[model samples]
Target: MSTPTTAPATDAASAETTAQAHGVELTEVAATKVRTLLEQEGRDDLRLRIAVQPGGCSGLIYQLYFDERELDGDAVRDFTGVEVVVDKMSAPYLDGATIDFADTIEKQGFTIDNPNAGSSCACGDSFS
Candidate 1:
């Protein structure tokens, strides 16, 4: 491990860097929520996978899906027992991303707090 010298949580772009352009932060709460969801679905082989794909309402779309397969250039980060794989192509754009789960009265879903996005679409399905 290098070092987590970035500032505490304030804005999303706290650790902006040119070398490791993209940064991601997976909250413990989110990891726990994922573990519970996997258990409920009886998918022991499933893991949360986050990726950035081109062509969306904006310039790019944030893709979050469950994956069981692993390929080359994939960065795997394990939290508790949950695994998150970021593909090589998407890693750069998603370097400083924060994965979180929210269960509120309004909307209950997983949210990706990415600082790389300069702008987001109206639907919130994609960003640039």
Candidate 2:
């Protein structure tokens, strides 16, 4: 017999309310890589922005990219050596979220673990 798995809390509105509502942590390795990138760019004004966009099989997708601009209504937080900025609109969808980096071949990249998502699609794209 197989045991059933229960989902995370169905509501994460508070955590998703603002950029500072919850904290996101970065691994030492990931932070170091970000630091190196900034040093190489010779620009400290850039930030690592994480956003949730509509698409993917799960009806939403995670977007990780570098941004130098802060638009109206943005949640910004400093994670050790890197500044993580998530737009206001994307906050609720990504509340209680953590951005992590893995060096292993199986998961060698930046990944977002969002508590707000009820379920992620089969391909790890989009979420309910």
What lDDT tens digits, residue by residue, belong to model 1 across residues 41-125?
9889987888988888788998888899876667777777888888879987888789998889976888888888899987788
Relative to the true structure, how large is the alpha-carbon lDDT of every model?
0.80, 0.76
Model 2 spans > 4 angstroms off = 1-23
| Residue pairs in collision within model 1 | 22-95, 22-96, 23-95, 23-96, 23-97, 24-95, 24-96, 24-97, 25-97
Residues 4-120 of candidate 2: C-alpha lDDT, one tens digit per residue:
977556445544455464345556677777888789989898998888888888788988888998777787777786888878788778777777777786767777777889999
Worst 10 residues of 1 by lDDT: 13-22
TM-score each candidate: 0.78, 0.75
